[model samples]
Target: MASQVDHRYIERLFRAYYSGEVAEKIFHSAPEPEKREWAFLRLDGPMVRHVKLTSIDDLHSQLDPPPKGIYYSLSTYEYPDYPMPDKQRIKTDVAFDLDADHIRGAVLQEVSRCKSCGWIGEGDVCRECGGEVRKIQLVDDRTIKSISGEVSRLLDRLANYLDVDIDRLRIFFSGLRGYHIHLEEEPYRSLDSVERIELKDFLTLDGVEIHHAKEPDSAIIRILEECRDVLSEVEDVSVRQVLESLVNSKDNPRHFTSIRKRLGEDRVLRERVSRTVRELCGVNIDPVVVTDMSRLIRAPYSLHGKSSLIKTPLDMEALEALDPPVIALASPSNNMVKVHVDYVPHLIWGGREIPSIHDEDVILPEPLAIYLVNMGLAQGLRHV
Candidate 1:
């Protein structure tokens, strides 16, 4: 059963939203879902449904009891009756979802509950029961740093590979892991599924061969730079020597071909180069987000109920300095509530680690308490 406080928190967010500017922006088109087409909302458990909105005022009225999340259909139909692709389909902005799974050395919070024994534990599995687990992981600061770097790479590709204007790009925190880069410009918004797939291929570097015939000079330079970066980290003198020789070759297609040939012959070296290229160029994008026009993304500036964090827009210029805890704070109240935690290895607050104990009462500010409660690390006592 859902707790009263949990339910009320969602209600408070909705009330705040109705009084804000973002809700007006989301329902700007005055979308109306008919028949097979509908707007999606995430309520509580066992509640995944759609509602039809006729006007902007209707949206305001409908969201009186705010939902945990809001996502409108990306696919737009001419008749507004069905989501059939053949019916003169309209626009879908180019979007990419980058997750923290690719981020290395980040401590991601995990709350797993066992299917067989109903045992809850930290990490990906139930320690006592060893059953199949459902996990809810929180993105940490390290993850934000890693994903920000990835978004920078993506921005580079958007400009260089796809010939997109950098100004068209809008970056937003997922209110959880990583960021969403939305291309809100002319040609990109009009790009069809096949064209978007082509864009996806370019961003993901899928089927890109590092051969003389197809490899570009810019790509060659990127490969050489990555090789240099990996070689510098390597302790083996022989491996470094081999990589140096290959990377220092003539800056041409033939040299790149030779480099590929040499790297391919040695399995260990090939794997190393592959990992480096993947790390440098590959983006962890949810392909369905880009491919499916009917897919719904969490609306920007909306609250992520699970984390109690706003899916806030970010300035790309200062991505490295982004602080997740600071970004998650939407509340002004400093009132602390004592929480009964199940288990959490460490708690990061105000950009620093704080004292915490498993299965013990720990007092935290309202925002942090909401975060911990949502993450399943602790339960906020109503009277605390």
Candidate 2:
């Protein structure tokens, strides 16, 4: 059963949200069925216009299994500024690659794309036009591996601490440099935008959780201020504003580049925005796992102090002295064994999570209370 919510909780949540108290921690709850309700939104929001969506061929590698992507649902709601009762609520179906692309494409419309630099621009000039875009690795079959190492063990530990059922936790290989966790649990399903934001605000930052902040709202400062210089394009503004702010302006303000509205301005502003986002951001993202739901790409400096991905200075047994990665041997030889990840879902093997079990379990050196999955951890798990 789900927890009973009251007007007060809702009020507090709305207040926090309106005040820009971002709730980036919704993916921490270990709730059973409600787990699915819990998910994460990526800080590196996709640059989309119309939709000729990419294929879902989600990738998983040995050294680095690609970083997970943040997940957000197009919810329906009624706002005070608007009379319409249905708007973007923050709750919707949890889907994967082609599935997500298909659904999101329905809501978005693809426009201009940077043919030279692979930049997804709105109504703007291609990267080659300005000849200013930086170079990136080609997306091919020998995909770029970024995770799938000791990171997975870290995820298991956090998940176990939060008590999220292992079964409902579904991990995905985000097309980018990360992984995505999908929580199919409750109270999560019941959350509206405010509540969802509150929850999101609570867990995972560029890599840390806000609720666990040593200094009040430290996570907020890191996410909204420090990382603002290179986040996503507004779901509303133009690329010119993006460029002006980058090349012309001094500070980068946090905003959304809506996927559906605003085109003319975006086209004119895209070039500059594209430059600042790539050059200055400089791999500015560090994937943070949320209750096995979303993966947020944040500044590593802002979260280096809070990440639970056990440091890589120690070994398995030594790591066990702390929180260890759950490991299970396929046979007595111990040559081929499985690492139990009943808790944490964002396990970073080589900085990314493993999308398949066929790979060997990668444990961190200095571990932290990392829990392991014991058989069918989901048999008794509930669904929200």
Give the alpha-carbon lDDT of every model. 0.61, 0.27
Clashing residue pairs, backbone N/CA/C < 3 A, model 1: none
Q: Give the Cα RMSD of candidate 1.
A: 4.5
lDDT of 1: 0.61
Model 1 earns a TM-score of 0.77
Candidate 1 per-residue lDDT, tens place, 1-384, comes to 335776565467456655676666656522233311344354554434344456567567656567777655555556444435544556666678887865544457666767787676665667877778877675555557656766776777678656788875777777766787777677877888788787776666555433322443456445445436556765656555545655665466566567667766777766554455454445657767888877666766666666656676677555657654434443334456666776655556445565545677777655566666776666744536
* Alpha-carbon deviation at 312 in model 2, angstroms: 29
| Predicted candidate 2 versus true structure: per-residue lDDT over 1-384, tens digit per residue | 111232222223223322331122222212221212112221222321111111112111100211212222222122211322333233332211211221111222223435475443334465447534332211111121222322343345335434555456554433222333444455444444454443433332222222222332333333333336444544435543433333322232222223212322455344444443333222222212222222222211011111112112223332233222211110001221223322222233322243322123333211111111111111111111
